[model samples]
Target: MTTAPTVRTSTPEERFVAAFELHEGHTLNGSNARIQGLRKDAIESFKQLGLPGRKDEAWKYTNIEKALRHEYRVLAGAPLDEVALENLAPFLVPGLEAHRVVLVNGRFVAALSHIGSLPEGVIVTGFAKASEAHADLVNTHFTRYADFTTDVFAALNTAFAQDGLFVYVPKNVIVETPIQVINLTTGDEDVLLNPRSLVVVEQSGSLKLVEGTHTLTEAKIFTNAVSEFFVGPNARVDHYLVEDEGANASRIHNLKAHQEADSYFSTSTITLSGDLVRNDLHFLPDAENCETHLFGLFLGKGRMHIDNHTLVDHAKPNCYSNELFKGVLDDASTGVFNGKVFVRPDAQQTNAYQSNKTIVLTEQAQMFSKPELEIYADDVKCSHGATTGQLEREAIFYLRSRGLTEERARTLLLLAFARDVLEQIKIDALREHLDARIAARFAN
Candidate 1:
């Protein structure tokens, strides 16, 4: 039997690089120089920034120390399961002939993937393979949007980056079904998986993408994943990300999307469960006449903790953006929502809106919400709002008067509130599946 890698996190930042160096057969960023340089810079930045604590304004409410307080096998995992990949067939969107890309323990598994005939000019493969086949595209898009100078987690991920997912859609090609890129972390060992994906959609092209993160074992693990999307001019893209890790798992999901002129981009994040999950999503309309929408729904119970931080920057004029995030917290769970929108000086005629709503079921549950807007242009329409409270008494009374039990009425109201965001999903099959999942959560 292969011995488990013992990565002690009790020392936090002090032991990470030492542990990373001790891992056998581990090479930083492979043989690619661009990748090597990026990794070098990220490691240096991480050493300076270190791990952020509550003192940092952006991380004031969330306690990230728990992630570093334990030992994790950050370098290796046990052997792959022969049947694990086969069981993931249910994850494929129902009623659609979608291409499936699977990764186990952050390593791509080609034998388990299905790519039956793709649209012309579309490419999806593992990172190492993509780097060999489409070197130019990989050189251009890889690690472009990550500004590791500030975010330590981004820097750490870049430093430890390895084999992940790579996707490209050529100009004018419209993919019929969504592309599913999945990452599953098993209980082979107490490991930490670093998954990264680079997606580029060309001008006039359209595509739908869905990414999922799931756990299959009862081991303690951590996943630090980064995903970047580059939307070209006159293009359209819809992206949905879902994360459902084990009760003993911790994850840091970092997403950054850039939009070109006259392009349309929308993203919805659905986080169902986790021990400690922090999501950082940023949107930049870098050109004029662009449309961007951001939506998220998070549910937490027991000792689960969820933190969602989002930002939208309008760098050009005539851009429109809408942001909404909702959360349901019960037991001793903690929820945090912080959203910020910025309209640059030249971004006149920009229309931006932000709202966050939360429902706390018990007195032990806690929620912290902040919605902010900074406008440098005088002729922009911008608004922000945040509301946090329990279920409305009037609505509960009305439902009970209509012959529904109190518990049933509460469930119905909570489901109705959550469905508003779920209805925005453009894919019918995925929406229905998520609806059933939400219903099942409340059923428990």
Candidate 2:
């Protein structure tokens, strides 16, 4: 078993801290002083906690300390040529009628975005423009959902939350088409980028959001991204996160959501590739009669490491939640899944189920899975389990006997294993897009 590397020096983290400390003064002078106060408080909280390390339980398996040892250039409104986006043609999702928002090096680029016929009450704007144009919405819900007090990376992101996407749906309104937010990172030197998003759906409102990350350059990049969602009573939202960043990058994504009574919230994360990636997904069923579901799939190869940590907090009575995460690792890559379902004392009659399944093709590839449930209520039905194994040898042999090549047979079985979760994605074009990506992944 290989162990996490030791932190050789604290200089890199210290420089980041210094940079953030310097940002506090500027981040607190906005039109909404309350938002500034919130930023100030967040920076102070981050100063106290610093960055997470191997000592933290939630980050025990992720060697964040060692990952940040290398020097990184933090870009501020970096210049990106419009012509440079031609290389990103392969990442687009064709046949999808959608409004797209583009960001380069974590900054919004209006010239590159496609803003379609968005109806009234549907606020789709850049985080900066929305912060100024829709002050009420930004001031009211921007920093309310994610708990940065306990999460260090979240705090860091919030402290540096300059540009991203803001989607808001008013009561009784339904978004006509899906909205896609594409974040593209590019630079010459090693860079650290933080992209933040806030989404709010009012009572009886509905929407579908697709968030994608793509790297356009070969520079080493580290991304700390945070997104928050508030589902009002009876509202519905389908959220999707697709991570296709380049090979030389590290990514940490934190998604925090709170669902009200009778609300429906569903979120899925599809991680196709990365160097070191960690996803912290938490859902709070805070009111009665709510339905929540979480799904994730990660495929890694060649020294990559991916971890999915999820928590479902059932705080009210009579809520239902289902979760499943699957992974396929090869070429000495490592994948980890830790999911916990918590049914509080008052969360009686909560029906929650969690499961994790993984396949490691080579002996060098490793998968570690842990699924847990802690119930304090008596009338709750909660179950959790995890399974890890290699590709079924019999299935491979059967396919090979049917005139398929060894690599083709292996790819078929791998796709079969991931099909159950992929089918759950409701967007047809997106499903087809992911299918092509998966085939290309295994074609190598």
Candidate 3:
């Protein structure tokens, strides 16, 4: 028997650092002197920490060393014409009045965005633009919600992010319409896209936001993204992330939310494409009676790999959290899930639950799942479970006995397994669209 080819090993830290240096000299008019200082500090921190390796517990299954061994060019001042924007208009959700914010190649495109009429005390704009238009708000909570010390990708995003979207919903105000953000990347050239988002919902306020990510070309590109959210007392917010990038691309997404007393937060992540993807979600319930829901669905085919890590921290009493994630792997793909729930000593009467289920369609496919619960409080209820298996042979044979083809029966069963999570999406139009997309994938 012949041996497998040896993979070359090289550090990507230098290449990423060089890219930051090239983008740092550019001029940003809205950013003040103090903001510049903070950016510099972030860059310094990123240089020291660098990219993680297999030894790191969080990144043990997902091997970054083998995935990011090549050098990527830094994108600067790329032209984003009107034609590119028009090509994406057909995919927009119909019959809904949405505030559209467009970002091309990690930079905001002002001409393509449609900032329609907004209610009073509601502010939505770019991060660089917020430096001048809303300096106090930007300064107070720029990198306050998420901890970038252990996350190298998040620090890299903060170092090179020149422009990003920022949304602030003031106290006692409700955003009637959803805010939609379209992040498109043309990876014709090898480069890295660092996108950032900061959202703050004041006390007793509510907001709903949806985001869609797509690619235009076929090239090896890296999209490192970070989103920070803060929910005040009694506030409610719903967030959704849809990934439809090309199969040749790779992405790392970090989402963190901080919830105060009596607040509610829900987030859903749907992954349909990408070669190697990792999603990290952290939720902190710092006060009493807070509620949180986390859901995810990922489909992996070919040689793709998808890794998801979620953590819920209970710091106070009487909080509840529930998490469910599902995955379907085909061909020679792989899937990884690591879900952890932590309850501190002061947190009493807390209820937390987590479950992960995966279905492998092919014998060559692989899956790894680990669900953990760490409870420090004596009076709490917590549980975790994980399951991985192939398609039920009896169910498939039953469908075949009804005169259905083998392929058709398998497709139907896969769709039935995924429909439960898809039904959880509240948006009618988006839900229907996603269902159609999943159906079409199986048909082909």
Candidate 4:
């Protein structure tokens, strides 16, 4: 018999703080006044907030400290000339024809990316170049959406923000081709990466963005990424994030969006593999007649840990929002879902709904689901609920009696259960790819 390796619970604050100090001058030497000021303030916030432990209310269910037991080399973004386009074949969605953007070790590599198919007004490039070329636009919306004062990971990512993805769509223009951003981690050393993205869609503009992460090496990689989106009036944005990493990878992702009147914003998060993964998603519908939607699906096995924390703020009258998250845990894996909807006092006629469901496949598997609604408006209609249980044995037995094997019957039932959230994905190729992946995961 083999025993699992012990994890050290020591804090990694000092290591990161030292790395920041060693690289501060190099990172902020030629930046503008506003950019420099934001970096300095962000580092101070990171120092004050530090890393969260079990005592933190928001982090009570996830043990992130245990996943930080690696001696990671805090590094900045750099182009990878060694990686070729052929190396990305396995990570891409099959049969999808879209403009592809590639990032290696959190830095955008233009040589490996293909974005010529996009329209004239659409702007897609690395954050570093965008900050220099389109300084005014980047400065206006960079740190406006994703606040780092209360969240430690967001603060850290802001402090070290250098290169990632930057997308812009002009007013009244529609982008027909989907923009795919692929973030890959390679190399044999343990390291920590901070990536940032800022997307702005002007009035009446439309866009479809897809982001994914994959690990190509067996080394431990910790990725802390922050993305901000500004949806203008009558604009539409569909965002998707897919995490398909190895057991040696851990990720902390924060995405914040601000929607104007009559705008539509939706996001789907799919977690397929990882050692420890946490997603912090926030949507603010600050104007009347705005619509927001959030969906997530996670499959955990082999001691994997997945945590999702989401907040939908209904600050204006007649706004609407809906959320649904589901999980399937097997072996000794664990999952956490904490969804919150806040309706302000002036948000009259606001309609918000949230639900979380989970299926535990083994006795040792666990799931913590918390759905909350805090409504200060008397005329608001808000509801939230959670459910966690196992697959119905009667259904499985009934399928088996129809000449199907027990494993096959169970796989079919699980697929049907996940179809609700999967069907919500708008991208046909991406949805089909995920369907095949999920089927293979259960068929084995």
Candidate 5:
């Protein structure tokens, strides 16, 4: 009989526990002992779960063990300086006066941010600070909506989440300006960046938020980020995310959003660069009359890997959801898309649609797309489709024959293909900013 070779465990869980304990002593001044206990519990949960491997269903496509095997050195504390701000200047939206919230290596940097005059009832601040200043609100919604058990990374984030952004918009308030979070990573040292964002829009409130991520250092790094959004009854929110990181970095991001009755939520994610990136989005329409729109674009080159997994759950009647994801794979890159829509038994009159399209720019590039629809109710409308193909050589040749350079022609065609998804972004300033970045990415 043949026996399987015994596999050795990499690192002890106690190492992470010890590291977390060292940081836990630095108490957040305004938070009470109970909230601190919750933070400790989160870290303990993460230590137990550790990092997910290929055996895990959600992480099967993008293996973290291979991408992130080295131990990340916890970054030493430092104030935000001009050099850090200069490194991030390129990512700032050109002409919009945005409310900037800056975080460096997962720690809030107040000096590097520009805080606009918020509405009377709106509150935007660091999560640790919010826990101290507004403990009740922070305690109520911090980890209330997300299911940490199913998502090990989220539990890890909650465990190591010491500093991050917290935004709360009260009932009937509309924040005309967009809240911009620029998460800058300086890879001068190896570090584990655990970034957490909590957004709560109360009944009838509205908000627009934009998040940009960039790496300043050339050293290898890993980013483990989690964001939770809550949309109250009659509230509406539009969110945008742009990630342009260094090619050697690895990123794992999770977005979990919950919607109440008569609420609306929309998200557009643009990923232009990264060595290995995995994005997981979950939308739960818990009440009736809820609507959601999710769109994503990923452009990769030079052996990069990008995976996007999305789920829309219709638990109540009369909810609607629309999803579209597109990818452009060049060189030897790989792209994976898995989108699932579930309509519960009680979700009568549910409407859901999903589509994934990919353009392979090189013979070596690969793409895998799976769009699934699960409908339990008898009266429901749900459909899903996916496609993978090479770029249209005929169109490229036609453009080239019209006096356009081959490179420029290809860039223009790719831009046009991506425009359909970019145009869905409601914020004009952010849209233009992203367009410029996309153009610049192809210009090289």
Candidate 6:
């Protein structure tokens, strides 16, 4: 009778290292040279960066210590029994027709996915498959846009980037059908997931992508996800991320994008539910005549916490960028919004705007908003503003005087307050689905 070897690990970081070592031999054995190199580099970077704490200025407002207390293991589980098409009905946006891609516990599930007819030269598949089939393309943009050296969660995600989603559109091609990725977390024990995605749109090409996260189990889940988008010259890309996880789940998402000359890139982040959620969104308009837009909406209740940090870097001349983020907090929930716009010295004729607004429904609910602008170019136009307050009593009273109940009047006012962010959604079906969801939320 021999005793099994002991895996001594204390902190979450140490446990992650141990987990990586355990999975390195089997799950990472067949990876290509470039991927292997990325994993190695990422591990070293993680070691140097470690996990952030309250001292980190960027993460000061979001306290994740309690969320990281569990001993979470990374599971490359696929074809999970609990993840069937029937079980995904609640997650799918009604009346939205699109190609569906499903991932369970960070691994792609082909059985539950549907890839419809795509235009010629447009490739959409699992990351692992793309790595093998389009090695050159994957290698060129996998770790190029999202910087892992400075971000600890990004480094951790890169170290565990075995599989997720991959999309590529060749030059001059347009994908009519939107690509919808549903990320599901289901397990009996606490698990950590790293879902990595890379999307590339070549010059003159266009694409629309939507990614949503959902939880199917009550187990504690920590998702550290990284997604990179590349818009080539004269190309356009629209992206959306919907986070509606369970109360026992926490997520850290890092989204980075690079836009070339004459390109357009827009992203909207809708955070509906989570225990602790933090989103780091960054965009670099590196060439002239590039356009970027960032929009976010977060609704927090039941002691949940949501943090949104965004940055737009104007590195070239004649670029335009705009950002708007709003939040509604109730029942002791807390929210944070920190947005920054940086204009380089050579970025002349740059136009940048940022705004953040929040409504606190209860005295216990709190909000922190910080909007900043750093313009080094004299020819640039940059502005930022933030506001946090409760719903106007006059508006609610007026509706009540019009023969409406107090609760109904309050709900209507909140819905009107959130319309700015909701109206930005280009997809009519998706927008309607979210509008209904929001209305129901306030109605209840």
lDDT of each: 0.83, 0.84, 0.83, 0.89, 0.83, 0.89
**Cα RMSD (Å) between model 6 and the true structure?**
3.1
Q: What is the C-alpha RMSD of each candidate to the true structure, in Å?
A: 2.7, 3.3, 3.5, 2.7, 4.3, 3.1
lDDT of 1: 0.83
lDDT of 4 by residue, 299-414 (tens): 99998999999999999999999999999999999999999999999899999999999999999999999898999999988889999999999999999999999999999999
- lDDT for position 190 in model 1: 72
Instruction: Give TM-scores for every candidate, taking all chains together and pairing residue i with residue i.
Output: 0.94, 0.94, 0.93, 0.96, 0.92, 0.96
Q: Which ten residues in a row have the lowest lDDT in candidate 1?
A: 22-31
Q: Could you give candidate 5's per-residue lDDT for residues 308-387 as a string of tens digits?
A: 99999899999999999999998999999999999999999999999999999889999988888988999998889998
Positional deviation of residue 299's Cα in model 1 after best superposition, in angstroms: 0.7
Candidate 4, overall lDDT? 0.89
* Cα error, candidate 1, residue 261 (Å): 0.6
Write one digit per residue (lDDT tens) for candidate 1, span 50-94: 998889878888878656666665653346666455578656666
Model with the higher lDDT, candidate 1 or 4: 4
Candidate with better lDDT, 5 vs 6: 6
TM-score winner between candidates 1 and 6:
6
Give candidate 2's whole-model lDDT. 0.84
TM-score of 3: 0.93
- Writing each residue's lDDT as its tens digit, candidate 6 over 264-288 gives 9999999999899999999999999
State candidate 1's TM-score. Answer: 0.94
Looking at model 6, residue 63 earns an lDDT score of 71
lDDT of 3 by residue, 1-444 (tens): 113654544467777676667667574212776667766777788887877889988889999866777566555445643446576775586654688888777677777788797779888887777766888988888777666665677777777666778899999888878888888877457777777888899998898888888887687778888888999999988888888788878888888899999999998888888888999999999999999999889899999889999999999999999998999998989899999999999999999999999999889898999999999999999989999998899999999999999899988988888887788788777788888889889877
Off by over 4 Å in 1: 1-10, 23-26, 29-31, 76-83, 89-93
